[model samples]
Target: MMPLPGPSHQPPPLHSTAKRGRPPAPISPDAGPSHCAWLEPVRNALFTSGLTLDDLVVRSGYSKTRISQLLRGNDYYPSWEITFSVTRALGLPTRPLRRLWAAAAREADKADDWIKNCIDRVVHDGEEPPLPYQAFTDDVRGVYTDYARAFLLTDQRARWVVSQAFDILWVCWNTATASENLHRYAWRLLRSCVIARASRHQDGRPDLRAAVFSTRGIRDPDVPGHLVFFTELIDLLDAITRLPEDQMDVAVLQHLCGAPHHVIARILGLAPALTRAVDHHARAALEAILTTPTPE
Candidate 1:
């Protein structure tokens, strides 16, 4: 078959060919909705950075076509290496992007080994955590894991969240150390990791229904009493989730995780007085919620 003429009449270009580079193709329809969560932000970053395909090519060390493909979410999923390069060039924060990329990878059914390999290829500084960073991780790792486990209600998931938090913190060690509160910085990283994976309700608050199942061990002896206690616990937990952000965090870390007040203050980067006040308010609110009777 012979090729047809391109067009009856060519349309005007959006910009002068001299000044405009090839815009990225529309994001591939094959990409899942979950993938778009991270992909859209990446495209937005590129647009706001005012970087052209050629600029991305130069900074990301990938070809123009590859860079364009990555931005468009075309063909196969891009490895963490190229994605990280583009994001780094755009000066986006690595921590949240790392979580989003990992979620996209899982949605794409990328194997755990493949994900790790892709992440490992993106070296930071000397590709090793500094001595001080390592020491800090060692000191707080256990407590961080405990807090994650209590909030998430699963040891395996808690470990994964903690691992991801530590890896991102490792990448941003210099910035974390330079911050006014390293403990608080690391704590925020861990919290973000956990919450990113946490299931949510229709209203967008965390759906912590799994917490009820964690109390099953206490049901062995008194079935009736345990059921009543479980019902009350559910209402209490629901109330806790509705608390203001700082109060909610304080309640979860101090009451749910059984961490000391001073430790909670350090982890939250709050003054001890502020932390105590938040705890007091949280308790008062929970008490008011549970004690108030329902009207017919």
Candidate 2:
């Protein structure tokens, strides 16, 4: 991963990119009605299995309404029992779905922690304090650094991308009211910045596979026996840039930036269901792109 850029090379001032008009309504930690990420996969699996909600109800011994609620994320975090029951009904492998469920659960826990910290600060310290900007910068920088390295393929360029993202965040912070969930909001800003930068630079160009192959161990280390791995990574990045803009945004935000569906929906001004649909299509597109034979 690339190192975070220092303060010297500041990104340009935010212009039309910041969407700086009528601040979005303050978001609650559990504000949205969107389901968890695993819900769509489960739904797809159920469809493939020729099963309906009624069939799920019968299989899980849960009412239609209850099953709907669990799948819709209407009850905030779904219970482990509910997830396990749904997994059984879907008749798919357990581990991947379990991992998604675990991630959702962890996000819920983080929300709860943010709420608790706010309460502690207000009641104990007598002021609702915002997290230090540096701390927030440090936390998000690591994730964006990995994402930048994966996409840009050079440490200097990756650091520039991350630096630009933070510059956007700083602009948003000064202009908009502090959201209740600071980290989530900051992430949204960074995501937008990265997407805009990637799109602007891509310019509908073909893959630079030749250039990438020629560089080899110069920019990124070869590690003696990892040539194939490095080649695949470059291919993946090239494929991601080729994805449709909306699909690419969804893929980057969900997988690269680690934003949940609802947050992604909010950032993109999209409905949660639509967001999930785009994500599903994006994954399929990426799979096809990755699996296609590269020209000799």
Candidate 3:
């Protein structure tokens, strides 16, 4: 049966490709509704305590602009040093702020520890590890085999496939709150596993396949430098296939054009006949997704 065209599941908009160093926005007089009452106390405390911006800057090692922005009411969300320096600068003996400071310090420590635990779980002595997201392979299998049993058209294949893909996302999302680096690694890891999961039935795309798992293991131009480079390339390819039109995104396209097909096919389970179809499908999907309107 002819597959229906898939919905464009473009990734969320990202920050500008340029490096992030946005200038502090010009503070509106109307800005910062909640902290207005404390502004005078905070400012007067700075003066009475003899804690100049220079002193706080020197102690915290934060830049002049950062200190200036925090103090002049230009910014309200205070940093660790800003808050602490104010407390110490004021010589406040109050137990309330001290408790708050302790909680903030504890939260920061917890974030660090949480990430370390995830790292330990994901990477063993030195080998690639079995990831939690691989459980979604069941979803992939069930969708292909059992989805036809449901009322929807096989054309709706893209919808179900994309939905199951969210499980991999959940695994990564849960891990991200603890350690972003680990989350990134897990995301890439899941991408690769997903290719293998879906590849069970497809015909194949030889050149793309060779690139995904070449025994020779040449460093391809399209692959990213992170830990899961090889498998991610294949998963990017598989994502193209599972879509209604069978295409990859620009992010995924970069990976696809990099390597040979047999490698991609083996890793992603692409069939012998479907390679060219996948390539075309990926390109078209990108176009449609790029132009589609999104919900608020």
TM-score of each: 0.68, 0.35, 0.22
The prediction achieving the highest TM-score against the true structure is 1
Worst 10 residues of 1 by lDDT: 9-18
Name model 2 segments beyond 4 Å from true. Answer: 1-132, 178-236, 249-278, 287-296
Clashing pairs in 1: none
The residue-by-residue lDDT of candidate 3 on 109-207, one tens digit each, is 436454344333321122121354345443343332232212122335434333433433342333333443542343343343334233243464211
lDDT for each residue of candidate 1 in 1-296, tens digit (9 for 90 to 100): 21211334212212112343445668999897557766765675455445687777766677888887888887889898888777766555566567778878998999999988887776632234468978988888777887788668889988877876776676555557767888888888777777767878889888665676666534464666887777777887788888887888888777677789998897788899989999999999989887888688
| Candidate closer to the true structure by lDDT (higher is better), 1 or 3 | 1
TM-score, cand. 2 vs. native: 0.35
How high is the CA lDDT of each candidate model?
0.73, 0.55, 0.39
Q: Top model by lDDT, which number?
A: 1
